[model samples]
Target chain A: MKSFGSIRRNFAPWKDPAAKPYIEFRNVTKIFGDFTAVDNLSLNIYEREFFALLGASGCGKSTLLRMLAGFEEPTSGAILLDGQDLRGIPPYRRPVNMMFQSYALFPHMTVEANIAFGLKQDGMPKPDIEARVKEMLKLVRLEQFAKRKPHQLSGGQRQRVALARSVAKRPKVLLLDEPLGALDKKLREATQFELMDLQQDLGLTFVVVTHDQEEAMTMADRIAIMDKGQVMQVATPAEVYEAPSSRFVADFVGNVNMLEGEVASRDENRVVITGASGAQITVEHSGDVQPGTHVAFAIRPEKIKVSSKQPVGTGANAMQGEVWDLAYLGDMTVYHIKLDDGQVVKASSLNSARIHDDPLTWSDRAWISFTPDAGVVLTR
Target chain B: MQGKLSRFNIVSLVFGFAFLYLPIVLLVIYSFNASRLVTVWGGFSTRWYVSLFSNQQLIDAAWVTFRIAVISATVATVLGTMAALALTRYTRFRGRFLFSGMVFAPLVMPEVITGLSLLLLFVAIGLDRGMFTVTLAHVTFSMCFVAVVVQSRLLSFDRSLEEAAMDLGATPTRTFFHVTLPVIMPAIVSGWMLAFTLSLDDLVIASFTSGPGATTLPMRIYSQVRLGVTPEINAVCTLLIAFVTVGVLTAAIVNKRRDLQRQRDEHAALRG
Candidate 1:
């Protein structure tokens, strides 16, 4: 196994405490008057990782990104980049670039000139800046429009130019604030992959801050879910989705159906839950709890099995129900089944074809059950 | 139907122009009148224009005014552009609001009060009042308006472009020069033009601040008009009006080009 020290050496960007991590936020906090915009937070971003800080509005995700870019200094805590502390370093000094939500392309500059700005600032020879700017423009598929001003380009073209400009200097890190948030749904989707491709192509540490859960799930290798200036959970999308650390994580990440109940039985392999709503359900349980204690169980909508008529099975984990509602998505159909005790639980069934050989529509009495592994016990 | 309405719009526009520009026409017409009485026209003659060209004193004063206006306008533009960048780019900065109020104060101030206060300031500083003092005062006054003009341009500018430049490995100073300055160049030009006009037409502030032997063209004209209207003075006024017209036209052309560029950028922004 590679030690942490060896890993740092392997990734040269993390070599010094100056480069221990590509970027580090150590106990950082920012306050605006009486309101604390960012509370005590420490984060480490490794080299070449497409990390995302996902949260709802006013969640301080953008604030954290700004601190890294040196636009807004943290009131307390230290920001270190390439292992060096970013105390007195201004935005220009840091080897970091940012793509604003507005793109902020200079209107007066042609596509080539806008992309060449940072190179010029580096005092690179004129010929070299031109060559690099042209190369970057071609990377973003903007070579043909080099002579056109920002106003002359389309939004997507302008975005590419902005991208070209930032990447031209090859900063160590790229900070994107809702990169595709302004585009229409289709365009946004297309741009998302293009952005990912670009990030991978450059192999730069990219920190994307966004509120859209799907976008975070699709792009980031690691996701940090923030709420009220604190990170609730940080994990890969699969882990965060499969076993959320808390109820907030479960609800925020995806569609989850929850059941409140008490633990009637417990064992190493599985546990039986006697729901407060008068339904007995068994789930694969791995948590800290006592048998007499009250608890909640969570199941993904697509996890449960649905069948017409009562099953020829007798157990504490099965329930008789009637279909209350149905929702038809293009790929699957969701059935909202009301249990005998009046708890409406949702279950999704795939629709592979236009015709349904077995349809569970409204008012159809049915039996619903799931393998213990399908649902997990959530204590918080 | 759209064409006919557009034609009607054109006719009304002509009438509007006639009403607005007829006074200028009268000013030029009377400058050529043979009679001394401005309201009465005796005959068409070149006497006023001939006398105006022959006046050495008026020419010297005009040259002095031009020098002061050009230098002050250029100085004011540099300072104003810096102020505009500071104001628009940084949010929640210390002393920002105070700085903004100070920049805007001179615009609404009456010329008389400004003149008096400046004159007192000069006296307090133990500085002699003359072309130097007048140029200093004009730059001080012109800078505020220039800041305001440039600041508006900065407000409408896309700040992201500068960030992009920084990301590309340019220093903040480089990003500003390469990205920010080029973006707001039109506003800088327009601000310079505005300052130049204000300095060229100034009378009240220059009157209080100026010392002996450094009289500006406006000050000289004021003294000449006081002695009763002369064809020479009339000719000078007419020539000044022509210069102002040309300056305004040039400023408008530059402004229109900037406006078109801004609109194109906005449309592009909406799409990509």
Candidate 2:
């Protein structure tokens, strides 16, 4: 937790998008004895982007970050930062910094001293180091606790101090290792916004590693979902959640009601599939297959429309389901409906604009419907 | 952190304390007996205590033991700390397994075996059996104890503190002294204390390695006890126990105080 909390300010002296990528992992692989931590990973991160490496524990996201920070030497593959290969670079010598999940601030040093550490390492003048330390304290809003040791500070405060310390050095790329995993739920939510604001203001390239889907979805510009030492999907959070490229990404992101469907017809933009309930449904995505191909169509729970009775003139994509379970989440209600074919579909309806006569409830016969574009047909 | 206990536990705890301390209590009581023979106690007298203060040979042996303990303890602490750091901080190396085995070999091997081996080693190296050789042998095993104690402390430690210091601009060496060393100072001090105690209590190794003029207090006491159980030896044992008890109590008190402070901090963190 002490190794993360770094922000990389715009540092190349000149801004040129046509140039090379900020940080590149060119076919990197890490092996510890017989256990392989990371496979041949090749990834390119642009400048000023909030990229997330999303995965479960031991999926090589941490290993990749360690390689970038010069903690682990890649067994094969070259890691490059700012056009130079990080072949012999040690952690302390690297221009990149990491914020550990543990918020690894020095317990003996005050907040200011902790922040001033990297600056002093670079042999900056005392006055300049002081000024920068003050600025970092103000940025993290710990000006009052500048003299406070890490143990004297709260977890959230220590997190900010680590962040401040990391930013004080102002490296080219900042690596965050489960940055928000240590905070309480409420503080984590609030700090997510603060971090986004800080990142936007600094316009730094940030690579955050986390297992928390909510945190990654709320913050990252693009996320590379990893599984078993490989990247499963690399896309924006919206695209990843709304249109997962695979079954793994779909299940990993959020709750989705997957229906077993057979391809019945196809168009350039749309494919019609006959579901297990003998209902025709249309889904939109790239790639096309012939009729009778086994395809899986996924729809998020909130995208489904539920009503007590079927409308007279319905187009397509309609099924009758009996309410199996209801989870009222205050702001919205999630309904788990079991279709006639025994396929369970989940739907969520908001409590916004309060209406008393809603027909969706426990043990109620309901017609669940969705638009053609509501669900995405996962390829592979 | 709470030590959960019930009435039965308290009772058993009292019983356990009696079982452990009953022997020491009897020993202390017999140390005060003024009888010429150990089986009979004629009366309580201060002759043994007076004899201990006046015996120059015993005093010289005690001085030699003290010197050996101080030097060996200091050497063991420094070297043992480096060994601990090498084992814990660095990734596995080719010789790591061998080094670890050698360091901890003393704890499991027989004392007589260790004493005999060191005697052969010193003789082969053309080293005379004296305080120097005794210090070397004492340090070799005492360092093992120091390394284990220090290594446990390092295990419970958070390594990020060192990385943070290094990130702040300190070299790896500087970070060790300025940040890492200060944090682990309590463990290091305790390791040194443990090593010192081991060296001070050592008799077999010192006896095997001693030369013409370097008879340690333990060696002298062993010879005296073989001849007969003298109150003089009891007086010395009593003094050694007193010194050791005071030293151990001071260390435990200091550790407990730090533990309480750490608990308070954790409580405050939880509150926040």
Candidate 3:
């Protein structure tokens, strides 16, 4: 989260009422035979924004991206690009480009030719095409490898070529399907920043589809989490992580300990929850939830603390538990505590000191505690 | 332990190769015989080769066979590529199972049955049998082979390549020409060569489908063999073998050179 530079541009056009959407899907639904790949969905993407469609496979994220790319038409709605309807316009006529997951560089052509293909198809002048191709190669730092074929390059190099080729025409929008799904972990992390920088430099809207939550969180300004052909939630990474709207969104984005509970009492400032295991919980957020309504309390593992002795904070809610398991991860130690009510909760503490002083061990009597504002109440 | 050739393996290899090639070797040797007798070789002379040029009937049959092979192979390649595309690209079309069955039926159906059925079909349609009929028959059978070869290639083709082309502002037709076709060219080339060789060497199907004045090289050679084994026939067979060998060798050499050039380019890229 450290600032890499002082120039942080405000890319949140979604918050601006007067700002028009660069791409919009209005009540789009795509069906294949009898299966609905994308249900009735409406979404808006702003210009020059890094948007991510994040979901598991078969969750309709890829189908939504393909609809925007004009590869698949919605059986029931319209897609607009820059205020123009994108119906009956084939993919070739659409002002969008896609970098395929496989990095489908033409095997029969050299890197230069593959980058020049779209320009040649547009009947650009020969000199202009050459200049553009060279410029793209330079942008990807692959100027020396222009004459080589795709197979001759490494995986990261091939990916760069695909990026360069897809952006050579400077389309209004760029679609990337699992852009880094094929790379190794370390390389994928590095390429994520590179792709973000490239998108910024080109000032082109990028709609990336990925199943990896970390990838979406790192690269996208906003992510639309999808499930079962419908959008589950759309928000900034921090917003989704902090205030997930549903139990599904909370569990899918990160690790969470869920406690089925019923609302004991509700007020403007706080709500008391009675866990099924008889553990009383409290949340700070006030909602219209009625007393005695069934709900689930979702708390992230890192927000809870497990101590060998009873904690001394009066505002904190504490429960008696025994450590069931402990894992010492170099930077943090995770302890799985089983409460006396037969409920298990995970708590992690940062290992800031070099030496462990009176560390909690296996089967040790411990106190697990969190404040009223550390968890979210999920009604659905 | 895995790759060492045992004595038994060596013996079997030698025996298998000799069994397969001894007859062709003998034929080739006798094609250069000076004497008229087929078995008794007077000396190594080019007499049979010299007489082969003067045989007008053999020359005419050779010309007919060449024309039929060229026409049929060309037609078969086009039709087979279409069939492969249909089978691979259109996965959910109606009657897909029946279409695939029909495409593959000619491959395993007895050649005699196929030839007889085709002959009857032509007669029922009142089409005069000639070089055109022979070519039609060749096309019918060889197209299936081409389809099988090209279909396997298409099965392995990365479909995303086509999508990439379209995403880059190329229409479907242009994508096929610039991306799919060039990538599948090797398979198509081999399929066409196979069709040509099959048409060139066919005897039973051609005899059943051909009419008067459309005698192919196989038909002419069969008739002469029935009469007697002449050194002139051996000479013609030797020349046919030479032509096929040269063609196959040239193709292999060209393909190898392309591979080598690509490898060298890769090395240069890595080094620089």
Candidate 4:
């Protein structure tokens, strides 16, 4: 079996100065009445990049996608596609297609007609339209159900038909808005991998907008975490997970334990923080901050180690606490420990063995320890 | 207790149907009576039908009514569909409330008041009262009914389908014709049928609007009824009822077949 983790992924087009961006949103600002949907946002997307706009609801991620799809025009600024201005062009004239969140299949038409609709709109020859429709049906594994209406098909099948119809004309870019949102959990998981593989196979630039953080993490090569119509951070999934630039990004993407602290002192290579609990935490790296400046120390729950005994290690930061709560998940165990000063911190460990030799219960005295490099410091 | 409830339900069903259909059934049966006296029982005969065919005045009135119904229904359908689209799609336009009010007000307006107002308007305008005037009145009233029907169906329409069509490179006009029209076709057809039947059955508006040489079937039948009830009138009524029944049954069967086919296809897909 092949393991994706063992292989290094190459994402170099974004860093190459000579490569021109395929799509550019230059200072795009969209306003509906008095509400600012997308604030002066500028972004660059390269060709064949699977980019995801990740945000909570009403965070303007979908507004950005709609602007690209030409359903909406920015109140100010311009969008450029292949170095040409995309202003004043309607959605039908654009070289991009979108799969709607509702699937939006024509209830009156059969699947074959729905997929062929775009090709017919393009004034393609009849023979070519037929062949292309057949090919799209095969691509989505829906060849046997071409005569069925959208209502007759299952949700997953209808989703595939929407996908095929959106891609029937082989658009330069495919924009998906909450693509698997209507499917069951098991089907959604399967479709996520299938979508990733499809994007890779077609080498098409895909811009997906989703509120699901895990879906964005699983499928996108690069993700832009958005909040209040602004990009907080844009990086690879691993970078966003390991080195989030802000406390919001850290908290949005996954679970994290935040320790409020003030910088006690700064050395040439390391900074010592005095937590609100009065525990001294020494970090290996120092930020450009003055001494006594307030900051937040964040660490993932998986990175913290919990032991019943006073742990002996390579000078790791340790906190004394009692187990306040414990949840025994089938694959992992989460322990919430409360310090003497009444601060709760969470730590999780994988259940590698079928049976544990020892288990920590509620009210058990424990020590939570982590290395200096396991946590990140955020000023915002 | 269940048996008693079921018996009560059966009784009510029978009573309801009898109350509704008994008069029409009697009228149809009496149309075929051989005797001239309506109250007398007579053997079944086709003499009334033959007399109806030979009655040139009644036939002329029927012909005029048919023409008005056909012309008015077509024009009403077009105008009503446009009104429905405007009201639903242009949500933020000025005077929308007034427009919707006018569209719906005629549905509940007293027919005598509507007829009197229309008659006064025609006289004020100095337009000749004839078939043209009757058709205009019919169109005016029937258009409202068609608009109400189409509007109800349009309210439940999925607007995203039109967006999808446009997203798939179809122009707005093409999207309406190819997607919107086909999906809402059932409502439009039923609306047209309603307008047609309403026009055919109208008496007061036609009477208020008609001039010489434009007497409709109902006007002629009313004059004859004022004098005396005739078997010929019954025969004509039976014919009209037959036409309406055929139209309604065809529509119902077509809708049923479509629904059944959809259900079957869904079942097959589930099994697969």
Candidate 5:
């Protein structure tokens, strides 16, 4: 498995002050009748960046993508593409293309004709259109099925034709709505990488909307987690996963054990928190915090260590508990340990060995421990 | 078990088909009778068919009916398809409910009332009634049936296909011509065929709207039948039945072939 971080190393244009945003949404809000689908939200996407809008259904991600595609207009704000206002421009006039979730290929046309449709719309020469169509067919690896109609092809083939047709015109931006959502698991996983590679090869700014977090994490350079038509946090996959900004983000992205507590003591580099269950958790932190402030310490299951015996050095970060449940997932085992104070803490350990020498079973007394930097202290 | 039908099912199927086709079979078999009377068959002969061809008045009426059916069906198909598109696409326009209700009103309205109202309107407008008036009346009533057929198709139409066309830089007009029209063509064709058949067989509306020298086949046959029952009438009826049966069978075959092609394509897609 190829790591996503290594594919686009040192690509942080958002952090650079001089790098002007290629696409800017300035306080865009869209309301349909009595329902507000997209609230007043602003976001900036750089050129050639694979940006993803990640959320559950009806979180305004699709609305934002539609606004960019010119299928919809923002009610009260402006959308700028390459320093030009996109307001009042019809979808046909805009230099943006979208691949619909339904893979809306013209059913009457062959694959070649479907790909040639946009090029012909621009009144490109007939020869040029044919050449472009041929190139797109080759690009998406559908050259052999160029003459087949959409109904004659498989689902994945139809998806590729839709992609080819949308990108054949070389639009300034390509918007994809739930691009890989219809494929089965193995195909979806394979297509995610293909889409990323295609985006990089074309160097077109790609903004994808998907509710699948794994898809967003695998293909997007940056993801914006949205809830109730508002963005909760915007960061890379690692940042959003490792250091979520809120309780919702931590819980929404993946499974996490949230320990509700209040700050017990604070220092320059670390803070100790006393949980509601009377368990103390010490975490590494640098932000200024006052004592007795309420907070939640969020930790992923894989970060904590579970064993039958107590560890030697850990004091405040360790707690004695009984093994409540365990699930063996082939690659790792998750242990749910119930503390004496009636709080269940989940811990997962990698199955690196073929045979376990001493595995903690159900109802066994155990101790769960974590390092100071393993968990994030969320104040909200 | 799967291939064999039960005795009760076989009996029901036989009774259903016999109930529908027995009268038509009797009419068809008697068309070849040599006797002048339609009910009594003296012997087999082609005399009635030969005389039927020489009947100039009947020939002229048939020609007039054919012309009216062709012209009215074509015009109604165009106007009705446009109406269906407007109703289905622009769902929230002003007076939408009223417009849709009016479009569908003719489907359930009494044919006599429609003919009477159209006759009154033509008379009030001081327009002479003839083949022109009959064609106009046919277009008015038959367009609603076309609209109904096309509307149901438009209802199930995937709107994203149009959006995809627009997204690909085609104008709305171009999208309709290139995508929407081609996709709904089957429905439009069936609607036109329906309108043509309805106009060809109409007698009451034609009677109310037509003037002298504009007699249709049904009116001619009705007048001839009132004078006497002739074997010639049975021949003409059989010919009409054969024409309509050929048309309906051709349409069914075309639809069945398209469906089979699509199923084969899907099977190939799955295998590939």
Candidate 6:
């Protein structure tokens, strides 16, 4: 089995305490009239990191990004880019570029002109600007589409042009607001990997704001889940998925079976709880918690095992249930097991074989079981 | 159902077009008459048209009117586009509402009242009433029309394009010139055309503001019409109508060709 530390081998600057942050937001708060868009938020982003701010709409992720790009000023506190305060700098003078969600390519300019716009603004020599534009076009793999206007290009091609235009100047940091939000599903999936490779190739710090959790999980080195103008959690994808800090993070990231319970007993690394539905739940937790404290035991569906016959020698983590529903996905089968106490538990098993000789069907008596280390105990 | 036109529809169509164009058609046909009288058509001839070219007074008036229209339209387009940019880009400022109300007030005011007010203001300022004052008065009223035309286009403009330009390291002034100006060029051109047409045939305002030397075409035509109508006057009016028709047709053809090109580009993009 692959462990958490092994998955991310060397590129973890955030883990080193001595490493200085490339960008820092210090107690920033932005209030528009009565509505507070960002409320006393602080964050640190490392150099060359592909960071994602993931949240639902109106969660202030875009506002945070705009603030970093110098389009917005924080009502209080300061933002520092490489130790320099970015409070009064205009967007034109800032060494950061943004790829807008609308992919705001100049409709009047051809593809080559659009990509050359930024380099020309810096007053580069004519030959240098032409060479840089050619390099950008080749980087985005649009060699034959230099003369096409934005309207003459396809949506995906326009997206690439927008990307190439923003990065042609090679800013210190690139801010992407919903970069893949405009692409279709298949195209978005393909572009996600391309963006990852490009980020590695350019070696620039990237800050992406997206509402899609799957996109964040696929591309970000670290994901910051935001809610109501506050950062709920910031961690690597594996840590966020396997060990969410709260019930909100657990439910927001993926599907989880959260059993509401109170702590009945505790040991060094194991905590047993009596659920509200009268089922005994045991999970591995090293945190300090008193007995009788209410908590939630969160487990993902794929962590639990469902079988027709009850497994032998299983204790508090095993429960008898009936198969209430099942979904036969091409690569896996998900069973919704209704326990005897009327709580529905979801368990997914991979469909490794082509056919099942004795498959558990609807209303069939089944057993759902998991080990103590499979789930986490959330205090909030 | 598609090819057949009902009798009621055909009758209404004929009546609508006739109501709009019958007088103009009569004027055009009478311009070609060999008779000196406009109402009597004594067969077709180009004699009146030939005589129109030699009428030095009418030619001078036409020249003055053309100069005023071109100068006033160009000035109004520049000022009105600036006003539109200010109104749309800055949504909140002290007295923004009052400023916008004053800018659009001339649009709804009666032309006679506007002309009278402009005449009073020019006289009060000790400014001579001549080609300059007349151009100034036309610009005052026609620029409001230009503002309204450009304001509607600015409201629907995507502001992110400007922001993108700024983010790409261009200054605000450069962004406006390179991005905003080009994107809004069509609206600005149309606004200029509208102002030009408004200034071209204006009679009341021009009469109020013109001095002894600057007699415009509309003022001359109105004075000549008081006497017996002549085929020479009809010929002049016909030429004016032909100029306007050609202008309108060229604009329409240009717009249609642009739209067709856009459609073809979109189709090619879709196929790819």
Candidate 3: give the clashing pairs.
Answer: none
Off by over 4 Å in 4: A1-8, B1-15
Superposed on all Cα atoms, the candidates' RMSDs to the truth, in angstroms, are 5.0, 5.4, 2.7, 2.6, 2.1, 1.5
lDDT of 6 at B268: 97
* Clash list (residue pairs), candidate 5: none
Write one digit per residue (lDDT tens) for candidate 1, span A1-380.
Answer: 41211121133332346545667788989997887878998888888988899999998999999888877889999988877999878787788888888888776668887777777777899989888987898899877788887778777777787778777789889889998887788878898889889888888889999999989988887789998888888876766787777788888988988888899988886778888766677777666678978777888888777889555654425688899998888898889999988889989878767986877778999888876777668877
* 1 against 4, candidate with superior TM-score: 4
- In candidate 6, which residue ranges exceed 4 Å CA deviation? A5-9, A313-316, B1-4
Error of 4 at A194 (Å): 1.4
* Cα lDDT tens digits for candidate 6, A1-380: 64453354368888899999999999999998898999899999999999999999999999999999888899998999999999999999999999999999999999999999999899999999999999999999999999999999898999999999999999999999999999999999999999999999999999999999999999999999999999999999888999899999999998999999999999998899998776777788999999999999999999998888877765437889899999999899999999998999989999999988899999999999998888899998
Tens digit of per-residue lDDT, candidate 4, span A200-260: 8888999999999989998988899999899999887877887788999999988999888
List pairs with backbone clashes in candidate 4.
none
Encode model 2's per-residue lDDT on A1-380: one tens digit a residue: 32112323333322356767878889888998898888888888877888899999989999999888877899999999878999987788888888988888877777888888788778899999999998998999988888767887788988898888887888877889899999999999999999899988887889999999999988887789998888888877777888788888898889988777899988887788897768887776558688888888888998898778884554447789899999988899888888888888889988886666765778989888887778788656
lDDT of 4: 0.91
Residue B180 shift from truth in candidate 4, angstroms = 1.3
Task: Give the TM-score comparing model 3 with the true structure, all chains together.
Answer: 0.95
Distance from true location, Cα of A6 in model 5, Å = 6.2
Candidate with maximal lDDT: 6
How well does candidate 6 score on lDDT at residue B24? 93
- At residue B173, what lDDT does model 5 achieve? 93
Q: DockQ score of candidate 5?
A: 0.86
TM-score for the B chain of model 3: 0.97
**Which is the better candidate, 1 or 2, if ranked by DockQ?**
1
TM-score of each: 0.87, 0.87, 0.95, 0.95, 0.97, 0.98
DockQ of each: 0.45, 0.42, 0.63, 0.72, 0.86, 0.88
